[model samples]
Target: MEQLLLNVVTLVTFDGAVNWTVGFLTTVAIFAILALALNIQWSVGILNFGVAAFFMVGAYVSAVLTLPAPEGLESYVAGWGLPIPVGWLFAMVAGAVLAILLGIPTLRLRDDFLAIATIGVAAILRSIANSVEGLVNRSRGLNGVDGFLEDQVQGGDYRWVELAIALVVLLAVYWLVSRATASPWGRTLRAIRDNEDTAKASGKNTVKFRMGAFMLGAMLMGLAGAIYAHRSGTISPLTFSDLLGTFFVWTMLIVGGSGNHRGALLGAVVVGFFWFGTPLIQESLPDWLGSRVFQVRQLLIGLLIVVFLLWRPQGLLAERDRVSRFVTRGPDDRTRGGDQGSVWERLRSAVSR
Candidate 1:
């Protein structure tokens, strides 16, 4: 009986560890996607504080299109029971459309006004979802949302499958965004970001590029929303959490290295683990302080963000100012010493002399 009890305890502990790891990876994957989406706009000098609007839109779009109609939801706006891919595609489209609509009127505003306008846009969108019974089921929130590969995921009991799905999507987005940012249009976008007047005077369409970046970012964010909705098997206003959602994603982007996609992923992994871990740690605290656990967690995360901003504003990994081309060197490109392994080899030989 003693041995059996010990074995049971060991099995439980191992299972808990696996669950924890799976949750961490899933959080990192979803947040990494959000960070990358925000970076596309932020890196190009757009301040999109209303990203949650896109997130909410995506979640609802995917849920409504893919989920089978709930028994009582027959009189509601209703779901089409489409394939998961179709829902995701529509989600991306919806996000891009929303971005374009918002950008047309508000992108002209710069800095603080732009942020405020975007925030208002988000508020308006959320309000519509809540007030309109035909839409988003009147904020009752969708349930029984299905995953992309439900059978393979085993109803989420096997968390590894969900993590794999999230990671694969994250990598694909990274590759596409990287290519976009390295293109000629991307260079033009950067020029406009650096100096709008200069880029405009030089014949670049500043407004158009800015709008494009905003739309692109919104699409990625929408994709993230779809993933979260399906992965969690439900979504509601509670998930968005007003400023809380925006705060962590922006923090991740800034803390990980704002300008690079890799930085976004890094920030997501590093900060996401801590963010998710705090709630678990709260359970060990005294009952008196348990009520304020959420506040304490936010305080800790906020403090870390402030510290990073004050001391290491560039983040753990800084963005490169210029692209280098080192592999283009030929035999003639070598030092006069005739095909030395590298410049370092000649330098070493001279030093030995």
Candidate 2:
């Protein structure tokens, strides 16, 4: 019992440092994908409470696609034994398809109702994963899913391979999402988010835009799951859980500041740190409290959520749309769109405006 409470050793040595660094970066990458997915929905004023479903679909789909069929020990598992890359592609498609199917009817619902409907969809998927043996091998989960890496890297461990892939993927996705949010398309989504009726009135196909954004975000979630499965070498329905996957990702996005890509990425990093750090923190706690230290951490996390909701709702970084200032444009220019006080000067101008 006392030994269980030992502090987590830091990655002091070079080898250990490399491993930890890779693992940390991989964590950041995966959560960045998930948080960005959530941000896509939230920034568009779409309340997606079932983020776990898309994540679960992606992981399971990739695992099923890539894994070899189980022998006597396992039963009713769907294993195509395809290449991992194929699995990743299909996983993303699967997530997008799932989102489309779910979003078709559910998107019509507004706000809380849509949120509830989405969560219900997540619950439905979980139930199916548990009940349908052919779907995901039921509770046993699909295993032996690393044939691609074994063939490609053929090395000491696949962690480095995964880290490299994750970093590259993170950078690529970050650039794409950033470009997307800065484009006219992103502006349209924001317009719909702020006022769907106005956007529709202005001839924007609000429904199509919402559906497209939903699909795109789900694809990212799916991609995250695929990479995660490749990294972890296995996946189960339990992997995309409400508490850990869905709610946790949501918390990160909210805490990081939604509607901003940087905020979403930063949120992912911070939340990921706290998440992985919790076990170490618990182990480091005094002997008497170490066992229950996890509960304390949970308490702290909940308290943070509550405090942020009540007070700092905008989070550590406020959404940057408030200040789309051109360096050349003077304050007197007053761009026709709206709010041209360079954010900092907003307070000064507020009294007069």
Candidate 3:
């Protein structure tokens, strides 16, 4: 047993830990942006399940745009030779456009139907990415794109600089989201989320508001995607695989407590640590145990999701009241729970009363 323990410890040390503090902080910045995107949709627009598609779109756009012209492709499009910032901006614009297009078809549908449509859209997007050689360089993926910050700093202690930049971006996003949610535009979005018909009757353009929320949310997600692409120094269709990457974003948003940016950021950091830390911890176990640890870890993650859904569906730091409290009418108003209650139950309650 002692020998086995020693071997495990040695493996971890030998594996050579990357500067995890920097890696983790970078992940936090990325997922915090993603969670805020979802918050705009789910918390403010009552939309769900389309975030993955937006993220994938953003990633692909940034990667493809930043990629140097491949031999044959040079004939058709000129390489911009732009910096990562410009690439990021392009990605955001693509995200917004895609969001508008997606919203046009799915936003008109009711909840479950909308979810199905959005999931289908995500699948379609992934399929196109996998098949389109001209667009995403097919299955081979984008290579040689410069890391966003690689040129900005150099040498050993650069991780500190990376952390500082991430913090600054995080703070800026917090301010933006907070201000938007506090604005009248945000109030309209909340009303639409809580009660679309009421919001429409109250002189708000519900459809337009939902679309705007989705587009803005998508823009944030795109910014994150751009950062991630540069952070990794390359990207592939596989990078945005719904199972591997998209689900993690969902986990971060849920764990952080949707609706509030701070909760999203905290949730992202906590979940990012767990996602990376678990594997590190497992690597230190006996070889016999480490071989099976991945499966066990996945099982635990699944269990955690189930438990959180049942006991804390709103998440760890969910608001006691939503951010749009000023526009809210009453305490017992059905809008309090929004569209979460079963339609039949709502109807039955109305009839009973």
Each model's TM-score, in the order given?
0.85, 0.86, 0.81
Positional deviation of residue 291's Cα in model 3 after best superposition, in angstroms: 1.7
Candidate 2 achieves a global lDDT of 0.76
lDDT of 3 by residue, 259-329 (tens): 76666776787777776566567756888878887677667667767776777676656444544456544
Native-to-model Cα distance after best TM-score fit, residue 6 in candidate 2, in Å: 13
lDDT (Cα atoms) of all candidates against the true structure:
0.77, 0.76, 0.68
Error of 3 at 181 (Å): 0.8
On the 0 to 100 scale, the lDDT of residue 267 in model 1 is 84
Ranking by lDDT: 1, 2, 3
Writing each residue's lDDT as its tens digit, candidate 1 over 292-335 gives 87677678778878987887676655555543346444444433
Sorted on TM-score, highest at the top, how do the candidates line up? 2, 1, 3
Candidate 1 ranges with C-alpha deviation above 4 Å: 1-12, 73-75, 156-158, 285-291, 323-353
The lDDT, on a scale of 0 to 1, for candidate 1 is 0.77
